[model samples]
Target: MSTDTTLETPSETVSPILKSVNPATGEVIAEWPVHDADAVTAAVGRARVASAAWRELGFDGRKKALLRWVSYLVNHADELSELIRKENGKPLEDAYLELILAVEHTDWAAKHAKKHLSAKKVSPGMLLANFEAVIEERPVGVVGVIGPWNYPIYTPNGSIAYALAAGNAVVFKPSEFTTSIGNYYADAFAKANPELPSGIFSTVNGLGATGAALVASGVDKIAFTGSTATGKRIMAAAAERMTPLVLECGGKDAAIVADDADVNAAADGIAWSSFANSGQTCVGTERIYVVDELADQFVAAFKDKLKTVAPGSGDTATYGPMTMPSQVEVVRSHIADAIAKGGKAVVGGPESVRAPYIEPVVLIDVPEDSLAVTEETFGPTVTIKRVKNNDEAIALANASKYALASTVYSKSKGMEIARQLRVGMTSVNSVLGFAGVAALPFGGVGESGIGRIHGEQGLREFTRPHSIARQKFAIPGMELLSFSRKASTVKLIKQVIKLKHGRHT
Candidate 1:
């Protein structure tokens, strides 16, 4: 493990309460105190107070402040990316990309929040036309953002940046694995805007308990990114308070390689999609279904790419260690289970893991019922299955309980196959492509998760729509208020409905 210890310790430490344990070396990277419940409450309270003032600034003012933040992040990308790499054990290149994308999200949210969430004129039926109609999208007040370890900055900033730009105060609780990265952002943001209350962009340090508290802390909404099981818990807790939540959870995403695909390109995309970031992405492809006609050629090419690839520790590696140590066992069990059920490791086998770093494993003939194919083996593992054609490929890809993201590889049939996949976002001839497009919505269906982050969907997710209607004039009849409604009035209403919504002669 490379420990530069480059961060300057504050003269007045907040608390030596939280500790970052390196997944590769099992060494302590940094230590800080867990914020107490009182502290959390104080932060939330301050956010509530700050929100009033912040919201009063209007959309343009808030956009300028957030733009300044984006400028800061882009200018100091290296410093932020390094912090993320050290804390989360991801390659610096990947970290740098995540950092830059996060800044993009910030800029998008700041620029688009007003257009997406502002009041607009709405139609009112003739009966209610006396008053003018409008629909307003209002801020949800305080939003608690509990981010994930993988893509730490981008994932949570999807919510944090949106919430802030939408006139809502954010209380950010980053994953413990990447808390320092979160802290660095929070501190930098504070430095940039001292007038902004500490709570408006507060950072709470702790574990799951802190997150649970935030979910139940009377916040108007909660935005969470993590495992499906944990997402369920967060949803249930939020249910008690009737607070809305955006849950971005795990996915057993898959890719399909049709007979007409560029075999080498497909292989490259598959390897990167599955093993990049040590297979720690919610949208990462965990399975591949190839048409039997091209299965052999694809597998051979994929194995060739896999041969040159290796999981290692360092700042410059293609991928890094599993951010969470416990995930190692999950990966192992999945491999073991696949092998037990007639699966063959085309390249790497069960012995791929050596402490924190797990070499990429490519398996074939894995049964559909195997744990590796069904569960989220969030490590450097990919299971390949044979299919008859595009239909079979779609079926297998949709078979998993997760439907977050998918990739379809084919020259002519790529888009057709993508449309058939059940996943929320499908990349045609590309891997993780939707995330790079700021206009696309990112989320899942089924157990993979609900609610979208990024793009226009992201800006709308943190706001609530309020529709108002004004009556221009009364209907031709007085039947709307009186108990005795004339048959003519009923006929007129039916005619109006049909004229507005139905095809006319």
Candidate 2:
């Protein structure tokens, strides 16, 4: 899941700095002073003051600035990818892919924000035709963004880039785990446009108090990517002022393999989806529901595919160590519970819980109500269950509190099954495919979170609409809007309404 524990108010320590380390080797990478509420307030004040000038740039101007930043990122992909490998503990190739996706989304937002947020002349209806009507989109001033560490750049860009494209200043607070990456990103924007004001895109470094201060600070909106528990805490704090929020929280995504599916193809797709990036992906598949007919064959194929995948710091490693040390225990507890409850491990077991890395563990016939199946296991482990048919598979999959995203595999019924799954997004034949297409709006319903962060909807999320109505010409002796209206005018209007809208047919 794309979750950051920035809302937890931990006890004070001797040092007022955060140290960034390589999760694989425990090597120190960098450090930054923890910004408290007062520092956070100053940063938000800068963003608020710069917002006016940023909004005055207009669509074309903001688009140019955003594109320049994107170009800078593309040129520095290798450097950034290397940092991600060391700091966040992902393979170099996967880190590069994350950068590529982030660039695609940033570019998409810059190019399309104008088309989506621009003023439009809407239909005023027949009776109101005499008065011209228009709807114009306006930026919601300064926005406060609390980013996630999982996909540091790509996840937060869902808010930062789009907000800037829609003409608003942003004050971002990146997760303490990936502070360097976040600062590099915001610095690139300033480097690209030296003439622009600084606070248009800024960073605040710290943990809970910093994020908490940003929420409490007077900003137009708050965009957060984090855990459901922390998301609830943010809601409680936001309730003080009734602040608007866009939260993308935890997910226990499930993949359904149907009777008509190609066993080999489905196995390959979910293996990567389930274990890639050490299975830390928020939209990654953690649960699998296979038809009884294909259950055994699908299980064997998926297990074999996962055998080649291992976690390490080498160039050939499929993935790296778990980024957060605490998550290793979460994976272990879930596996223990699944085994104690009569589940069979098809791949690896308790021995897989290495300190820095956990090898892939594939379980079969785990209870649906168990922690492994019901909760978001942000690790390299997955559970496979046998279902009678598609009906049973869909029901079990939709039963989770998270309706974030799901995958369906069926040669003939792919689209049909996808349409029925209750989720914000579903991939018919592939896994996590919706993320690459920048035009798709990505968010979930229920406990998964609120609002979206991509495409035209993502652009509009940072703005509000204003309605303007103008009167063109007045008809003689027809004062319908004023008390001076004549009785003849009322009678004629009644006759017209009777003919136009009187019949049900």
Cα-based lDDT at residue 111, candidate 1:
87
1-505: candidate 2 lDDT, tens digit per residue: 6457647543333258889999999999998988877777889899988888899999999999999999999999999999988889999999999999999999999999889998999887877778889999999988999998889899999999999999999999998889999999999999999999889999998888888888998888999998888888888888888888899999999999998999999999999999999999999999999999999899889988987899999999999998888888999999999999999998999999998899999998798889999898899999999999999999999999998999999999999888888889999889988998999999988888999999999998999999999889887887688889899999998998999999867
Model 2 regions lying over 4 Å from their true place: 9-15
TM-score, predicted candidate 2 vs. hidden true structure: 0.98
Tell me each candidate's TM-score: 0.91, 0.98
Candidate 1's TM-score: 0.91
Backbone steric clashes in candidate 1, count = 15
Whole-model alpha-carbon lDDT for candidate 2: 0.90
